[model samples]
Target: MEIYNNHKRLYIAALLLFLALTLYAALIPAYKAQNDNAPLPNSKPLSEQEALGKAVFVKEGCVACHTQQVRNVEMDKFWGERPSVASDYARNKRPDIWRNTANLMGSERTGPDLTNIGKRQPGKEWHLIHLFQPRSVVAQSIMPAYPWLFEIKERAAAADVTVQVPEEYRKNIKGDIVATEDALNLVAYLQSLKQVSLPDGRPVPKFLYPKQSTPDLKGMGTQTEDAGLDGASLYAANCQACHQQNGEGLPGAFPALKGSSIVTDADPKALITVIMKGYNGRVKEGFAEMPPIGVNNNLKPEEITAIINHERTSWGNNASKVTVDEVKAVLAEIGK
Candidate 1:
């Protein structure tokens, strides 16, 4: 009886030991992953203005609509060049008041992911106008306008940044809409939300997930024929965000491509020059200058010609097609 009792106690001890080992085995990898993926050394620290802007962003509930995380999935290719990794968000710090001062990986994506917004859209002027009234920039955008962040002035001061609201939306306002400091701060914060690249020599970590089966499709064999890249498609991809689909840009914001003398110019050099180097000169008062698209976007000569040809052809304008060699010549002549 004594031997049997001792044997039973030994069995219980062994079972407990086995259970503890199993738990440790399950948790050690997670802890190691957290330790291995430290934030990059050159990760940008937010400025005072940007920190304040982050407070405003939280206060305004912008996180409710926008997600900062770029998940690893085939469908998320549009959000960023690669799926977001742990290190990408390692630098993010939450507000001081929260006990969990670590992550702001939003719960849902009512708006587009902002992980690479700084690189994707670097135009401060565009951000200002969009913040003042999203509908003016994106015709079908469901974003709520934050008009309170702006003030109506009879004429904008030299120091004030004027936001170009469309006439239809500005009918009630008496003067130019100037962005407040808060608005500027918010823009700064938005610009700071860039995803830094992983450190050198570090391979992207693979996330383990359950295997998913391909979905059933009824008409896989009847898919439409492939349409090769065209000038129109090129324009739609690059220029339509500002110039708009109809080529009628928002009045006083982006100049309209439709019937514009620049688009229909006999000498394509000027257009090529603008494409190679961004136009930032104020052609008219109370309007923002155009940023150099070619250098900023790194558009190749062939791509520039395609965009120029598309802009000239679309919107009922008749202009000679620009060749790749012509674009190259202009780019060299202008020293771009």
Candidate 2:
């Protein structure tokens, strides 16, 4: 009764209880995690610029919409090659003494998971344009544009990294859009978000409730006769994001395939070459470089033919369809 009535004793007991709870709940767990989970061998610490970008990402509330973790679920498989493990984030450290922002594995994936976005979309130009205006690239993107991360300059200097905003989005602004240092830094940090490959002989975690399989035509060649391959479906899966469903691409940002000279050309070499090696020649014309889709996506000859045929035939195009043999020959000739 005396101990309870004494203010000093009551305060001392409360302080001790708080200390014990903190030590057991926070300090002990943190210490165990630090000791038990070593960073993957291939994972490197973030560079200075990337660190700054990370701060900007947090400041911009990107964590609210985007998640960095890929769960061990079939649906999450699109975000990463393998299910994320603890060691995937082991290289993360506290930003500073004032902030414990080491774990940014956000919940609620309003936006697509960015666990392996670096590998999925590695184009700086794409990121720049997307940042300036999300709708420029993805017509249906619900993400907010971060226009403050860029500046409008009358004429960009040689040192300036300019974003080629589509004319529709830039109609009000009379100057070229240049990426600010923070924007570049943010892109750098985003580009650095690649999933590290596990060491050889390591048992990779499998995604649960595996979806029924379709034949993977990435590495192997499919029959020349289409063989149940739907060209429209292939185009939707691989090309629709840029070229769009109607084949009219976003003006100034992506070239339209509808009535395109390359798509309708009698010779298929140029078209196949562009698909395999990619095209950067249109940069001056405000078009971002097309990534080497055939190579990067590991598209087989039949798949490439399907995409090409779809482009050549659809959207009022009357060009002759390309065969798998022609595509294979071209791929071999180009050494792709």
Candidate 3:
């Protein structure tokens, strides 16, 4: 009994010592990051609505699944920001939740990484729609709906709430009730999850607006055969039937074309290549991307070119067109 007691005492003492060291190490830097950088976000502070949404995030125990800090490795490999430092956590926090505490880690990426998830594709309405009913916009999304966030109103109350969709994006909000202020706040909080740049220990700009320049295509894809076709039209004809006209792409398969920055970026080459040669990525980011649909026996190079130009230019964008020549060049480069 005495021997066992001695062993138990030693084990407890060692465990306590280890915990004390880990906490001291982790908390110091965390505290410093928060205190140092504090509330001086490149963007504005949280609004009343956003604050409320944050509370919802907490009450929902989102922490159990996700982490705010972007660990260095995660930031580099997965494109997440480095781990949340003390300065990052410190600030004009009202509740000071975990002010002096340090406990942040991930159980699994059961849900997509929330780090910098806000403004993921701009257009606040998209977030509201997705939150209200993810499967409506994302065929394979695993995230649960937060319909409680909305009030379910009849008829569009605000111009902002009524998003422009294809005549075919038929699955409208089930109930007429629209989203409420709290729902808006949650959306706002979500939009606030932006990529923060801390250059030389001084944080850089974090904005809801895209930091990079967007293109502006005016008269590009007006080909004789493909003339007058908008992005929606092209998407429906060439891409949508497979990717879904609404951009809800098949799960574990084809990806959504709508709201894809790749489709919107100024670089028409990538857009052209993706459309022409098709793409392949691990199932993790949305499944191994499918083979190029345009390169198949069904579509022609000119049609692919017209479709790419339309998608990029029609989505409230100003991108240059992918000339048939450019599409040709891509095919040649791919040895197709």
Candidate 4:
């Protein structure tokens, strides 16, 4: 009561109280968090180019649309192998002396989470084209283009990494599109954003509220031949992103699958081989080298068969449907 009546005494008491609250509420927990969370052993620090890319990402407001975090939910599984943990971010450091390390694990996911985008879509060419015009690769994509990140050149120099923009999206532009240093760095940062593997024997966290397992729509399951797989669904999940729903791939970047000879061939070996081993021979044709989708996605024989059947039957191509047994034989022969 006396202290309350005395202004100087009351001020001293309030200051002490505030100090105690700050110590208990902030300082202590902050110290504990720093001690408890260590970077995963396999986690690598961002390289110089990747750091520049991150700065570009921040500068360009990429965090406004995209998120880096993968939540612990079954729906988020497609974005990452496992739920993201604190260790996933432990390696993050400040951008430089002038800036603090931004909490880049963004809040709103206006776009797909990039927790493991490096693994999901690793092709540099694809990223470059997508950056130039998202609609070129994904017709339904609503992402805005970053044309400022590229330059139009009358003819690309030998050292230039040219982007293969499709004709329609080119808007009658007269020159080849070359990625600027900022664009390349931004992609490097994106491509570096892979989910590191947990150290040996560490129990991985499970996604919460697991959805009832559906048919292997993405071909990452062990469905039987008679399981009534949806070939169209398979195509949409695993193939449509690059090949397009119409089977007409992005011009100058992805080859058309609509009237592909490989899809209609009597022997499915060529198609299956490409799917399994991946293909780069078409790079000379201005198309990006295809990653081994079948192997990378861990597609089962039945799932591969379904996708093959869909591609063969759809887009006005009536190639005979390949059986699951045939797919199995092909995969086995290729040692996949």
Best by TM-score: 4
The Cα RMSD of model 2 versus the native structure comes to 4.6
- Candidate 2 residue lDDT tens string, 18-89: 999999999999899889999999999999999999999999999999999989998887688788999999
Candidate 2 stretches with Cα past 4 Å from truth are 1-7, 214-237, 246-309, 318-336
By summed lDDT, the worst window of 10 consecutive residues in model 1 runs over 220-229
Q: Estimate each model's TM-score.
A: 0.68, 0.78, 0.48, 0.84
lDDT for each residue of candidate 4 in 1-103, tens digit (9 for 90 to 100): 7987899999999999999999999999977997899999988888999999999999999999899987888788778878899999888877677997555
Residue range 181-252, candidate 1, lDDT tens digits: 889999998888776666788786443452453343345553121112276776765677677788998676
Clashes of each: 1, 0, 27, 0
In model 4, where do residues sit more than 4 Å from their true spots? 6-12, 214-229, 265-286, 294-303, 324-336
- lDDT for each residue of candidate 3 in 1-336, tens digit (9 for 90 to 100): 564679888888889999998889997876676555644355466677767777777666666766655554422223243445444443336566545222333456666666655623233655665666665555556778776766644566555243222323325645354666766777777777655556567653232332333233347563333333354555554565345644555553346666778887766667767665666554465443444555432355655666777666664555666665666677787665
lDDT against the true structure, per candidate, is 0.74, 0.85, 0.56, 0.86
Error of 2 at 245 (Å): 4.0
State the number of backbone clashes in model 1: 1
Please give the lDDT score for candidate 2.
Answer: 0.85
Model 2 clashing residue pairs (backbone): none
